[model samples]
Target: MDHIKKVGVIGSGTMGAGITQLMVQNGCATVLFDIDKETVDKAKESIGSRLERLVEKKKISTEEMILAKELLQTTTDMNMFKDCQLVIEAAPEKIEIKRSIFQQLEKICAKDTVLTTNTSSLSITEISGQIENPRRVAGYHFFNPAPIMPLVEVVQGLQTAPETIEVLVQFAEGLNKKPVVCKDTPGFIVNRVARPFYNEALRIMNDQVASVEQVDRIMKSAGNFKMGPFELQDLIGIDVNFATTQSVHASFYGESRFRPHYYQERMVQSGSLGRKTKGGFYNYD
Candidate 1:
């Protein structure tokens, strides 16, 4: 909203980096913040390489790539966000961490600055509950590999101003994303509806109805899914997917259908957290 030319992204992980890339590519000046300089430096290198790859693929011109890189900046200071028209928090999915960030953001950001969380499972209303001005806080959920994903969920908390939602929708579109406005329900839309795809697959495997390989093959071949549930889980990180399921289950008050299978929990406990850990439902080694 307000022709957001300067934006702040409060993380430097995969999602944050991708969001920053999207902002700069769209000609918005972006500041990426992290707790430490090492992380900020690494994200800068990763973003540079990604933009260069886009240029090599002819997806972007050399000049455009340079312009994007120039628009991007990094810092460890939260006070630097004073001028940001919008700040999207892509930090980890911890409530304390998020609440703390918002508390600080309330002091640093302008009153009109649209503060939003990219949390996939956390309740937007609850996340904004502690903010001084909850009206400006909302959810701006982006999927993994944000640069390639076109869909964005503009979630509205109970206290979120209607104009905030309107602003987020237009802001999403400015980055060439398809924005869908949704109530601040747990898991929102995709994560809630798509849970069965992963859970039932786990159930089937645990029940011996089929092996992991068989279930994956069937889902890909017969179901015509781009990636099998297991394959997708591996790519998404087993721990991450399991945490989302756990969060949904808790939000629903232990609904039977949303119950997490023991096998899934065991995978996280074993530290086989998918490709990031080099092992999960399948071994990458």
Candidate 2:
């Protein structure tokens, strides 16, 4: 944990920005970077507004809010990450983009510095293979709204050293997060075990066992899930959810249980991409 005083977050969209916010909230100095300057600025503004909400809700004192804002350094320059001890990449879900970033980070950061990715579906080994120090690179995946989410998946690649995992678990705990160490298997733990919930729910809907609304209601009441598959899909973005399912399915080599639902693909194609698009299985407006 002491090795993580300075953190660097690449990408400024939802996940990257959220990770940066969490690091700052944990009293770590964070440098946020994106290819686009405006995006980085937007990420900063979004975090600022979230901190203000915490202030209004009395979750954090005004002084803490000020300090939170001060801990983050949002920028478009990649070189600023040179001094960071740990850098977490949250770029698009493309292997090439990740490889490029890791190669560049290897050049910029110290040889002993730690590097991790927030990739949900990609194989950690495949990503780390792009860099020189695969031993120092591992997967540090976080659920959305990172600061609020307690669970973090610490992925051990095929070549990941045990000491690295120990340090990562300690690092996550330092930020007051629960860390679950798992093999670099597809979907790690939660996404792999939870696939049946979504796949079966989608099958029920497609089979006309019930409508999306009714299924969601039943799941919430009977299954005790805070949100049902369709509803959660909508909130997570139909495309994003579908893509994750597909990736896991492919990673499993077309396993029957992990099959990607046809309805989900159709929804994504129809642009019913959840709350961000204002429409999905349910309507936003």
TM-score of 1: 0.96
Clash count in backbone of candidate 1: 0
Worst 10 residues of 2 by lDDT: 234-243
Report backbone clashes per prediction: 0, 0
Compute the lDDT of residue 278 as modeled in candidate 1: 86
Cα distance off (Å), candidate 1, residue 126 = 0.7
lDDT of 1 at 17: 93
- Predicted candidate 2 versus true structure: per-residue lDDT over 1-285, tens digit per residue: 997789999998778988998998889999999999888998899999999999999999999899989999988888999999889999988888998888999999988778899988889999989677799889999988788889999999988888888888999999999999988999899888878888899899889999999999998999899899888887767787787888899999999989988888898889999887889988899
Q: Candidate 2, clashing residue pairs?
A: none
What is the Å distance of residue 253 in model 1 from its true position? Answer: 0.6
Find the candidate with the highest lDDT and give its number. 1
The superposed Cα distance between candidate 2 and the true structure at residue 248, in angstroms, equals 1.1
lDDT (C-alpha, whole model) for all candidates? 0.92, 0.89
